[model samples]
Target: MIDRAIKLWFFSALVWLVIGPAIGAFQSLQFIAPDWMNFLSAIALPYSKLRIVHTNTVILGWIVMTFISAALFMVPRLCNTPLRFPQLAYAAGWIWNAALVLDLVLIWAAIPDSFWLSIQAGEYAEAPLLVDVMIVAAVVCVIASLHLTVFARERPHLYVSVWYLLGGLYTTAITYLVGNFLVLAFSGEGYQVIEAWWLHNAVGMIITPLGLGTAYYIVPLAAQQPLYSHRLSIVGFWTLMAFYPGTGLHHFLQMPVPIWINEFAVISSVLLGIPVLAVVTNFLATPRGNWSRAFDSYPLRFAALGTLYYLATCLQGPFQATAAVNWYVHFTEWVQAHAHLALAGAFTCYGMAAGYYMFPRITGRQLYSRGLASVTFWCMVIFFPIFYIGFTWSGVATGASINLMGNTIYQTINITWIPRLSRTITGTVVVVGFIAYVWLLLRSLRVGAPYESGMNEVPEMGIETPFEEARA
Candidate 1:
């Protein structure tokens, strides 16, 4: 039952991996030539709506599905027990996908806001009241399933990955409700404050911990190493929960919010480095003796790349949140680029790592072709940064010309033509990688090489996983 359940969510995540990014690539074309996407407008696929769809699908759809699949696979193994209720896990995945479809369909419908509907308020929180209710139901089911799995544990010790994932899921529920429902209770300035909080934390609290938690499990396994320091893992986990929630308002520093709010957000953003460093250092150091394996293992390489992207994101996030930097970069694509670094850049890589590692195990077969996987991986290594650079370059260039030089929009528009073209081209290239990845998965299922079942065997790592060490 659990096997069937894991496969359901895993394949669903692969489906979204292709879809969500394809929408984004199409949207990028609009910037390259405003009329390029005019046809999409005929079906109400205009850039405004499509942008919201792309973000929600990728984050709530793709990343959320991937991590849930990861947790379903990992929890029972770490707990030394089968999932408490496998059917609930299976039902939750389907429910989550149903909610996603409703969410996307309603977005395309462009439903108007009403007392009951709450069509669109914040960036990713744009789902209508109906969609929000469905999503909250799905999240609740997931939370219950995971906790029940932990409760049924035959092993006494819990792994750090479990800690991060369970804690992350709880926060996901809290932030989602607060951002989507609680804000409805307020208006005027308070509403904007809630929007800003949800906007940033939608990534910070939701994606950051979940992605990092997936990384914590995958990195050591692919490298065939014991966790470097349980002590550091604990610090990273605690500090993250402490500092991340308040930092959400940092996204709104330019607005006329309270000075105290600004100062608090800035302080919280800066303090995030403590957990960020601890986490990154732990992953990087874990592979010290087995660096060669990363080159050989697709999972490790993607995980390693994810760690680097995460480091770059956290370092840049706080720096930009500062008054000196946000004042400048906020005007440009810098914030958008930073977002991609976390969601599209880092977490996507982590999702890929999870899929690449788990798929072979799930199916009891070796991957069909490492060569095909290489095509996807290299595309990521080469084109992702190109896309990110072109994106960041376009924004910074536009911001400086308009904000710094005091040039009008007309003059700056002329200057931005080439950079926008570059952004579109590189973005399309990144999407090609996504397509290749999905194709590889489909093809592997049909022709993957035969392999022995590790499902019944002891874990290859041989280290203790009854729980995370240095127990709280």
Candidate 2:
């Protein structure tokens, strides 16, 4: 049976996946029709709080929790030992949920006026203390889980992937706590700087490390090959951990942060390309002659796309960080588009790969169908471009409107109705993708088979590797 901790973690992911996006959709619609649901809007509370909750849920509730569970399962297997204190692991899951619940309540209640303003500096003292406490609770829980795994068994040496997984969580815990509470202590303009830095920490230390760890585990396993360059992988991992934390300074380019911060952000961002290339080389080099084989597997396909998007997004990120380029795109839908593409498209794609890899093992069933998985992947391919291009086109139009038309943002937006209209229409395709995902997951859980059924060969890369020969 799948460990109870794993079950709870998956359950958290499923719940937040639905709730977070649903709220985001509501927020998106609020722009199209302001008063259509005035009562409901009021009930949801300030927009900033709602947005924060949604963002936090997606990041903490879904992504972090999912990894926490996956790592718990993987560690024992990698260490070649039975889980130590499995019951404690399950208890930690409950503690995590309770902490998150408190966080949600504090987030909603902290911001009194516009959700937007509360996130600002006016009510610094009144802001949520739960945010601070939640950080502590989260770190403690993580330490417990890791301790259980690390001490459970003795290996001659820890794998590189295991090192990354643990290092990512440990650093993320420290950074998350420091960025939110300690930095936000100063009230005035420092608040913006602190917040921007926090945003950087959230993406850099949290999401980026998690993604890296997942890729390290997934890529070599799928290719049935050891990593191409262990040295390069180690260099890339260390450089990224050092460099990514500063990337947040780019967000303050147009704002009134120190000018040097912007310059440093640009330089570090350019240096990021090195690590990006390193990882890309490692992943792509895996299936050299067997390219078709990896593509044939839907999980690998998603992972491939994720790596591709990661390169694209980082390239865009560095370019956009430049003062000349940002002057045109800052605060425009263009920035939003890139962010969504990177955060949702890139990360979600990788996460899907992990999920597909995990599903059958967790459920003790075979995938329902490969054809359905392929269909879902192709739909993603189509949906991604529509959103990407649509947002880029609209951003250009919006920039022109702001620069040349002498018209305000709201008025200029009306002139370029096609872009907004297309965006909403394209958004429907993403909804379809989510629906397909739900169907695929449910069917796999209920009707799938074991790896030894002549369908999938369970690779020896460790317990986390997905079986090949079935659906993704």
Candidate 3:
């Protein structure tokens, strides 16, 4: 039953992966040609609505669901127990996916005149009130199921992965409720401040913890080693909980909110590097002397690269959060690039790594093709960097033109046209790569090489040697 739930969540996430990036590619085209989507205007699917759809679909539908699947799989294994309430877990998956679909429909149904049906315009909390309620309920069910599993653990000691996963689950439920409802209940000049907190926590609290938890579990396993430092892991986890919740204020530093709040946010944002370094150090050190194994293993390769991207995203985040830097890049394409770095670059990579690692184990089938997996990895590695570089270049050029040369938005657009065009091209490469990835996943489900049962030998370097065993 738990295996079925994992497959459902994982495959559903891949389906959203296809949908979200297609919308993102269309959004990039809109940047180049504002009227490109004009034909769809008759149906009220404007850029704003589609933008929300893209963000929500990728974040909640793809990244969140995928990580949840990882949690469902990893938590039980770590605890040495069966998943409690398998039926509830399955129901939660359906409810979560349904809420995402309903949220998108509500966004589309909100014609210009029918504004009431539109979702709340919060950054990460854009679901309609009803959709929000449904999501909260789904999360509640997930928490209950997972917690029950944790309580039934046969393992005497809770592993580090268990700490991160259980803590993340509890925090996510509270974070969602507070961001979607509690914050909205208040009204004042400080509303924007409150909203910023919610927006920041949505990413920092929910996605970051979940992504890190998945990585922590996969990294040592892929490398065939114990964690580099258990103390560092604990420190990293606690520091993340302490610092991440307050760092949202940096997003609104240029606003009229209190200056001290912004300063604290900046301090917290910069200090976040501590936890990032600790976690990265632990994972990187664990792969020592076994790096070549990663080259041969697709899951290890993905996990390794994901950690690198995670490091880059964290470093870039602190630099951008500084006041002087924020003044120039806050409203520019730089911020968009940064967002992609975190969501698409960092967490998406982790989620995919987890999927690749677990799918074969859960389904008892080898992947369809190593060559195809390599292609998918190269596409992401080559194209996503190009995509981010083009966008960052466009942002810097546009910002310089506006601040230094006194250019209008029209002039900046014309000046940055080359990078914008490159962004669209590279984004298309990413979308195609993702499509192929999804195809590979689905094909493997039906026709991949079958796993031989009762082969329990731990090969050298902790690699799965059977597929290569036959090839050799």
Candidate 1 regions with alpha-carbon error over 4 angstroms? 113-118, 453-472
Name the best candidate (by TM-score): 1
- How would you order the candidates by TM-score, starting with the best? 1, 3, 2
Give the least accurate 10-residue stretch of model 3, judged by summed lDDT. Answer: 456-465
Assess candidate 3 and give its TM-score to the true structure: 0.94
The collision pairs in model 2 are 48-115, 365-448, 365-449, 366-448, 366-449
Q: Estimate each model's TM-score.
A: 0.95, 0.87, 0.94
List, residue by residue over 1-472, the lDDT tens digit for candidate 1. Answer: 8899899899998888888998888888777677758887887678988898888889988998899898888878878788877888888888889888988877777656565454676778888888888888877888888899899888776778888888888988899999999998999999999999899888878877788888888888888777777678878999999999899888888889889999999999999999998999888988887899977889899999888999999998989999988888875787898888888889999999999988888887678888878887887788888888887887888889978899998788778788778877877888888888888888888888976754331122223433333332
- The global Cα lDDT (0 to 1) of model 1 is 0.84
lDDT of 3 by residue, 1-472 (tens): 8888888888899999999989999877777887757766656768888899999999899999999999899888877788999888889999999999898988877644333455785787878778888888888888888899999988655667778887988888889888878876777756688788888888889999999988888887877775777678878999999999889888888888778999999999998988898889987887898888787667678888888989998999889899989888877899889889888888888988888888887888888888888878998899999998998999899789998899999888899999999999999998888888888888998999986545321212112323234435
Candidate 1: Cα lDDT at 327:
82
Model 3, which residues run further than 4 Å from truth? 111-117, 452-472
lDDT of 3 at 25: 90
Number of clashes recorded per candidate = 6, 5, 0
**Order of candidates by lDDT, top first?**
3, 1, 2
